[model samples]
Target: LFRWDGVRDVHIWLWETGIDFSSVIASFNCGTNTFAKNHLFRRLRWLGHRAASHLATLGYLAIWHGYHLGYFVLFLFEFGCVVAQEQLYALIDRTPGWAEFNAKPIVRPFVWLFGRLTINYAMGSTFMTMGLLKTKYWIGVSVRSINMFTILGCNSTIKSAFYVLT
Candidate 1:
């Protein structure tokens, strides 16, 4: 729900006011948005996919944080989550009646539950990556935690894409 409209409203308010402490604080608050809008997106516009630009932006953010392997791993996992969410939304939008079905009172709760579970799972892995720091340790932990269900869940999109291609 990070809508551009809220950001636009803040930008307009800032523009209408003179430079001040509040404006400076607001600018600092919007640093990520500013960087994405002004730098990464502009430079990667020719990539023709917002996801590519997003991946690049995440990589830049990871680099900005530090040169640690954990930082790169964490950001790459975040990029994957973003792509998965985007693909899920796009798929839902493209399928006739799917959005309506999801919106049904009876179905909505289950959908919300599933989404929450997925997000929690991703967050657990992310926190582990952040805590472990080293690539080998995190990789081992992740590998040990992986299950058949998770593997299938991750590959479902790839399978669907392959099916479409064929």
Candidate 2:
């Protein structure tokens, strides 16, 4: 079910972006060469999940044992990406965003962009969070996790840059 949901999310992403999956997959569309190069990010989001979770568990154990733990937060974020990707895919799939858009056709474009950017934030947030789950301390965490704590930092930066430029 999870795998299906993830694949469905990818399908929706492709569809919402106005791309045809069959043509791209069948080589009739080429997709600018191949799926690997063009879909690496989506594939990474799916494939790297297992490795990321394993890394998080190991890092958690190591930190729990009292160690250098510099990358613990990053490990956590990676794990979170794995989980969040699964969750957000499910959530967006089941959401009524489409219903709202259909009810207000004039705002369909805004809804489309909102959904797209929200989906991107979901991905980027998970990736950026990889920096926070660093090794732990009995009293307090090390400064290493600071870099990972603000997982949405990139989105904010992008928004601000766009606002400033616009």
Candidate 3:
């Protein structure tokens, strides 16, 4: 899926929280902003929705594209990348230090550029390559870049700070 899918999801969650459930899902009112403002529960629900939809879409692609194992692999890696990105977003949003770091005149540009390059490199395989073999090859080539972004999600300092705030 495109990056806009994530933006659309945030909008949907915000919209759903504000409106009535009757105007949405069976009984799951995802838009209850106050109920889950900046909480793990909210993030979990978003991940659930994201995974469910991606699973369905991947299944459709597998069927439509001749049932390649690569489709599943791509979806799996893509899911991890998306989750990592979400965690980073949450970390940056909640961490005052990160906000300060992001605002630095010299540091800001470097971080932004590095972050974008790492993300693009991580996602390149999923977006450009097809079939299990080709996807695997591209991912192997780009794994280093992907690891850097993933490391941000796993770093103890980042997690401790992020969790403490929440």
Candidate 4:
């Protein structure tokens, strides 16, 4: 699971090596103007779109490649957790007395274990890389709103504050 230790590890690595190996959960959109400042990169961004679409199509064929893999893995993880909960309740035989809690020992910590495994590095990389590769798709008001919502959803108001403060 992505507990404090895992986050600490990432921070340590970043501090020691000036490297950021953040996956999707730790990544967010940088504004387009910042990206487009690079002249050659701006032109090449168009080429990236055509290439990404073709690749996305190929990926679509390959078990829809990375996306489906992550999706199904997550599905199984959640399903197994539900089954475990069912068994936990059955084993408990009855609810608690204090508040009559009709459940078993909560394994909430383990919840995010499979979550992290299914949310593997490759899948996250593909997601962000695809987003980056499709600049046109992630630009303008519609995309900007979506990108902003994504960050806000992640509860990362800190980065947005950085944007505003700077």
Candidate 5:
């Protein structure tokens, strides 16, 4: 049921809103990119790497937003998501037979469902943090969310191990 075309619907809705959050984000991204290219990348070659550049850009956005700790937490969480996504794609590409397995018609729906659920969970957590500007509450939520992810990761690992043994 879920398809990439649904993303276009989301974009259309956002455009209809008149106040497009994406444009704001894009402006910030452009500013960060220019600064990174002119100042940061020139001074530090290591920071020119993709991950580091994303970190720097997100950090800049966090600071630009305000002095609120929640802002920093939100952007950091976003940066982590971006990094995780890149790593996941890279791993899928590098693992022998994994890419083909994931691409198989029978497996595609499950993959789409998993990806959508994960993205929705992340977005919900992020929006919750965004709404709660107070440091104490947002920190508690962030820590709890991190713990949940950790537990989920451990469960997946255990399940995989059991499958291997069986």
Candidate 6:
């Protein structure tokens, strides 16, 4: 279901609506590429670009699906997840010790599993909810788990950064 909501669709929508496809699609379609580029302010610029691109896609999706509250709520949820993941990935990249720690044979599987689950949980609401009431209620209920996982990930990342620095 989420697979059907492709970045290509978002690009087409933005094109139809007279917006610059390059700006939004750059982050939305090639996120890792943008994230990997070397520049002093890359992270800061990517964050802003990501926010705008996500919001634009969410708005288009909401309108496409009849402008329900679920779309908005799901947008908020996804935005948080993407930002958190970006920060964590950046931290893991910058801290060689943390990166090596996570890459160990005994630890890598757990990290992979957790990452898959977190991404699915972040997107599950959009696929599950239909109407405004159901969307709002479901988001309210499910967001607790999403947020918990996010907090846990962020705490671990921050701690790893601190440990590596010290």
Which segments of model 4 are wrong by more than 4 Å? 1-67, 94-166
Stretches of candidate 1 off by over 4 Å are 1-34, 146-150, 156-166
Best prediction by TM-score: 1
- Cα-based TM-score, every candidate: 0.65, 0.27, 0.45, 0.21, 0.63, 0.50
Q: Which residue segments of model 6 deviate by more than 4 Å? A: 1-50, 124-126, 130-140, 143-166
Give the higher-TM-score candidate: 1 or 3: 1
Off by over 4 Å in 5: 1-46, 154-166
Model 3 C-alpha lDDT per residue in residues 1-166, reported as the tens digit of each score: 6455434324454333322212222222334323333443334555456445444444554455555556665555544544555566788889878878777898866775666565455555555445345555656644664466557664443344334333
Give the residue spans of candidate 2 off by over 4 A. 1-67, 96-166
Instruction: Give the Cα-based TM-score of candidate 6 against the true structure.
Output: 0.50
RMSD of each: 10.4, 15.5, 12.0, 19.0, 10.2, 11.0
Error of 1 at 160 (Å): 8.6
* Model 6 agreement with the true structure over 28-67: per-residue lDDT tens digits: 4354434333322343355465455555555555565566
Output the number of the lDDT-best candidate: 1
Task: Sort all candidates by lDDT, best to worst.
Answer: 1, 5, 6, 3, 2, 4
Worst 10-residue lDDT window for candidate 4 reads: 17-26
Residues 44-79, candidate 1, lDDT per residue (tens digit)? 879776667766777887888788777786767665
Model 5 per-residue lDDT tens digits across residues 1-166: 8556434323343233222223223333454556656775455556546556656666776787787877787776665555555556778999999999988999987876676567666656666776788777667766777778777773443243233323
List per-prediction Cα lDDT, in the order shown: 0.63, 0.42, 0.50, 0.36, 0.60, 0.52
Cα deviation in Å at residue 117, candidate 3? 3.1
Candidate 2 colliding pairs: 72-133, 72-134, 73-131, 73-132, 73-133, 73-134, 74-130, 74-131, 77-129, 77-130
User: Residue 90's C-alpha lDDT in candidate 5?
Assistant: 74
Cα RMSD for predicted model 3 = 12.0
Q: Write the per-residue lDDT of candidate 2 for residues 46-72, one digit (tens) a residue.
A: 535544434434454446534544345
Give every collision pair in model 1: none
